[model samples]
Target: MFASSRKSSLFSSLFQTPHIICRGSSRNRVISGSDIAASSKVSAQWTRLGLSEKKPQEQKPAYATSDQRMASLSELKEIFRKADAVCFDVDSTVIKEEGIDELAKFCGVGDAVAEMTRRAMGGSLTFRAALTERLALIRPTREQVQALITEHPPRLTEGIKELVHKLHQRNIQVFLISGGFHSIVEHVATQLDIPLTNIYANRLKFYFNGEYAGFDETQLTAESGGKGKVIGLLKEKYGFRKIVMVGDGATDMEACPPADGFIGFGGNVTRQQVKEKAKWYITDFEELLRELDSDSIKMNHNDIFY
Candidate 1:
């Protein structure tokens, strides 16, 4: 009976697929293409998404040759020019590194977090446990985040500064909408001359002495579909006529119902689904800059009161 039981358990373990594991991260560091291909391929619930453009060569579509380039730049340019408010995703979209992951590396908890990530992926740990445990392991102090910024500033994507500047010049309101921590996103906003008030991201709470307490779970960005909710609030509060969201993720694309358009950016990193769905996809900000007219003035972003 003991031998039979062992054999049965082995068989079950080999065949069972578990769901509690961490298949997706907010930063999207895990889930590779080979893994995706091995997965059912029936639906893309937890696959074909990437933090970088390192997708399976087999999955890459035949290159489009509309001017031998990005097909919908014209449409994107139109939407961009007409937009009242333009929101950007921060981590991989505006900056090259993923903020939370960078914080982990800085806090000397990179290995621990990575192990938790592996466990989360392998179904040995629950997603909730993975997230909280990783946070606990990193417990990034207030000073750490600041020091991370000061010591090793996040790299901005090429042409992003120019893009934001031109949008501001055109009187198009630019806001940083991210699921990343406010501390990191704030730094990026400052570099771009974007106001702190214009940032919609998760906030980290701290003790009066500035020790890490926890992130504010109440923030709209702390939940799933939060970006969309924030865009809804942007419309209600600011009454924007036409808004555009630009980013490199599925969540960013999903925000387009609330937004007038979604522009896919692959300069820093490319995700498969984003490329396939984004009406206008570009790898460089110069593309948008080239499209933006110098004599632009339709809506005045400054006219709106904070």
Candidate 2:
């Protein structure tokens, strides 16, 4: 059934003129350069960090399959031509490691926490439950959290910096929305020059003595489908006409509706479900840049930041 649906979708895409309906609006419009230029820009409110030197030998994940890769790339080119706002999931999407897993490793519970994380991301376990169990095992300290930050700064996924820079130059609003902790993701946002206010993720709490207390359970991303809720909020509050989400998790797939498009990323980690369900999937960010350039969607440096 899925294969038949995909074939039908590909066939239709070949013949149909591309159009994206702006939700909460009356008219349907073809995606245009001018439309992208008019998208909203929101100020970010997170703390900035100094940029780190790029790793010269960062590892890349293997592609799930060659045939799936080709199809997804072809579809992604069309999607990119229409997107005005792109939200990136931090762990394994924009960054190489899962933040919590790294913390668990630091606390000497690496194997256990990693297995739980696998289950959570694979959709076999509820995210909140896995997180609760893992956190209890690790019980990270304030100093340990800082140590992880210092020793293992979130490594940027290949081509992510360039991708965000290009998107910004095109006057597109780029956001980093993660289920990861703010303490870690903040540094990543700073490195990418993404506004702190635009980042949405779980926040960690600490005692007055700087000991690890607990996470704020109230944040939307603390539970399942939180990514979708955040996407919906972005649409409702900002009035963005076209939004795209790029990630490597089941949660990222869940945001497809409010996002308008979902691009599964496998540069760091490849989940089979994300690869199968995403409208487009890719293992390299450069593929996205290439697609944009091929479609004449490239923006000059001077034309950006309007």
Candidate 3:
């Protein structure tokens, strides 16, 4: 889907309105001086455009893009490049679909489960509670789950394979942390070559007869604020000097204090709150891939799996 290294319109997208008119292709676009003035005026209201807020007491630069904090963007990328490990949120971040939502759809309780998931993600309902209620609605049997997997395997986000391969070449460890089921993310890990041991996600329980029983509540990912716990554990376990969490949710944002930094991803889905708060918000993996400086590694896209 992301086959083209198309220029990300993140800035241009936010800059457009009834006033400021942009002309030409997204690449060769042009805006009049009046438009620039309009964009600048709008820049003063970054929060309204879902742009990140300036750090308290930090002066906004006149030269900064309407998104603001151009300097902080550079600072975050420096951290990303130095990171010893990077943790990714599995559903929308690593794959194209939300695993639980997909499972719910497969089980034919899509609408009921999806509403709960929306609230869970928005932080109104605790993740643990949402999962409990959603699972109660799904009650998917082992066979059904397997059938869904075989029929509709997890769709990897475009550019992810290349990105993970690049991280590996940098000798940086990669992890998949998700509120999705273990069975689902394990498949994703296998596809990405991330060690199964590095996969942190919820585990489903089933009866001996292969019927759905429930989920293991003991897993940290089974509850709210679980992703941060996982990041904290990773920090303690590895003693890594720098770790970056990249995802598209509030849960992902919550992982950062435990994680050294958090980079928001929006290639598949953009969470507005995530976009507004992330000091370094990106819509495509290419933005990140460019930051890695591939010249040092000397690898080709063809060798990603090898």
Candidate 4:
């Protein structure tokens, strides 16, 4: 189980406006007061596509069950010991809430949107169809979008910050790749101290009057197997010998052949297909840290960093 204290720490860090410090650079870097003000203004203007409201309680789907979906922690630890990079799916894997679903709720179409999301994630519906349908239903306004950011910010998954920090210390490049919208994902990447350039997701377009228009059709993540394609590109560009994908959806599982490993995360929502297919599955991120600390898995720092 995820500890309450860890969740608290993650929430605290995520909501605060970051004052990024540049390390190992001769030019001392500090986020200027003006810059912070500008960021806050932009966040205020284009945050999320929802109004502030109590999130409806999410019911676990009947499909989720207690099954042996993971290898022994030791086995997983050994498998990932040499990973040079890690890619994470944002929505349910790294955050406790689904951004689009929340937006739909704010638009008073929660049930409809939730059903489509469930189908899409379960591999019953194509991601492109689901996204297109849901976006049309919501038709979120500019003000509503910004309110979603300010009023109902996405909550971080338990122990994710610690996991990311540890991976960074080990020189593993952490990337957040999602089928979600870039408007929200960009903020998440910034909060986690992940470079914006490393983040990949769909981008939404708004009319000059701030009305919802549509999304960029050209983004690779707009269709099925997009996550896998992104992973393939990363491998080609970085020449990473070993890469891992951590997510809670079938889309994440699609990255397996390109990614050396796939770890299913079910802390928020569990999908039966992902649980069954993943080589390892965990409900708590702390389990990963514990496995990484095991002595049986020798850390080859050189192989991972260089």
Candidate 5:
């Protein structure tokens, strides 16, 4: 009977494909049954969706040829001349990975959150609804999220920090708005030397006993189109004559109508909606700097925001 139960459990585990437990011997580590289940579930999900069902490759894409350049330096400079503040999306925009989704992985709810993220991003579900559902599933402790910071250091895309620095030097206000949690975004803001007050992202709520409670939906970014609303707010609040938004997702593309100029970053994941609609598309931040004529805008670190 016990053997039969074990077999059934194993089968269900495989179907659900939850988490993996790793064990090591003096010789080497061996994958356990739970690992198999998780792997199987992942495979099943991807297969059902027609996704590749494989880990993403780390290599970068080849640069576009000169003929493929969307706009010349002269054209970009004209736009830059009017822009006063630059707003950016955090995940897959300035950084290579999605922050909250990655945090969900650490909490053992990556698959579930990823599914919601997809629906929300693809315009099938409301951003807030998907976000609320995903956050509810994790119930992650603050410490667990902090541990993720240790496990997965937010990787800023090539030339991102330098671009932010340059923008700061040029007296432009740099803002990071993300659908990711504040706990994680705070670290990024600090590392980039951007003011914490200027960072707009989600903040998680906790119980008195340090248990995971829920998220502050008010501050958290709503699904994809929420970015456009944020752009509107910033424009109204700052009265900035020109606004530029940089991102690489469907949501970021929505900002085009609200923003004065939209710059798409293909350095990370490039969505067709964003690529097609963006005012300018560049693979990396360096391309933007080059297009903007970096030499003239370069200023001292402290010269920014003057």
Candidate 6:
């Protein structure tokens, strides 16, 4: 995705300031003075065509084109090259469904539980509080939860296994931090070759009848910016020079500002806030891995077992 001629210049620009109109990968085409003046005239024309004459900030750059705005994988690759570790969120980030919402579906409270889940994810409600209320409503049977997991396994996002394997090759630790159930993510942790100790997520409690009682509230993810806490903990433990975070939720956004780089995975679900705040936004894991210069590793859906 690199425009070799402009790649270096783009990097230079990006590092020049935190905020600027980034000339995307394909945006380096030369424009003469006449073209620039013509562009300004065109902007004035377009402004006159609008409902109001209020002009937008500097008018659209006459040179900006759809191709120029197209995001390239090279920027992300450069950032990841020096990254020491990447922390991923499980549900929706690595896995497809919100675990509790899936459980709610199995237990006949899908709509209600899903609503709460959305609110929690959308920043309307606290994750821990919502989780408690939802779990209380859908006291699912162990068989049901296990069955759902069996039917719909926790599949890793596209190219995630390859990314993980590449990180492994570099001896960089990968941590799966989630607010989802341990029963599910544990299997995924094993498949991804991440240690159980590195898999920080919520745990479930069951009764003698193999029915769900509730979730363990003691997990770090139950708190606000739980993912950030994990990031902080890892930073303190490993003393790494740089850390990267990858996820697809508000919870993930909390860690974005704290990490050296934050990649938003929009393959499963894309949130506007996440897309806006992430250091990089990608529609799939393949692009993410490719951008990170970690494409050499092989991956498969089986890497994220149920």
Q: Please write out the lDDT profile of model 2 over residues 1-306, one tens digit for every residue.
A: 001111122121122232334557578868887666553211111113344434478553231112322225545555566677899999888988888888888789999887876676566767778777778788877667766776667778779999898788667899888988877777788889998888899877666576666776777889889998888788777777677888998889877666667888999878888888776779999988776665553344546422
Q: List the residue pairs that clash in candidate 2.
A: 44-195, 44-196, 44-197, 45-196, 45-197, 46-196
> Which portions of model 6 show Cα errors greater than 4 Å?
1-79, 121-124, 294-306
Error of 3 at 142 (Å): 0.7
Which candidate has the highest lDDT of all?
Answer: 3
TM per candidate comes to 0.67, 0.71, 0.73, 0.71, 0.69, 0.67
What residue pairs are clashing in model 3? none
lDDT of 2 at 147: 62
Q: What are the runs in model 5 whose C-alpha is more than 4 Å off? A: 1-77, 294-306
The lDDT per prediction is 0.72, 0.73, 0.78, 0.75, 0.69, 0.69
lDDT of 5 by residue, 135-213 (tens): 7888887567655665566777788898888788778888888877766666667768898777777767666565677
Ranking by lDDT: 3, 4, 2, 1, 5, 6
Better of 1 and 4 by TM-score: 4
Q: Write the per-residue lDDT of candidate 3 for residues 1-306, one digit (tens) a residue.
A: 111121222112112222323556666667899999987787778967789755668774222223322336667777788888999998899999888888888888889887777777666777788888889989988777766666677888889999999999889999999999887777777778898899898777777677787887888898888998888787778877777899999889987776767899998887899999888898889878887855344344546431
Error of 5 at 234 (Å): 2.0
lDDT of 6 at 127: 74
Q: Give the higher-lDDT candidate: 2 or 5.
A: 2
TM-score of model 3 vs. true structure: 0.73
TM-score comparison, 2 vs 6, better candidate: 2
Among these predictions, the greatest TM-score belongs to 3
Worst 10 residues of 2 by lDDT: 1-10
lDDT for 88 in candidate 5 is 88
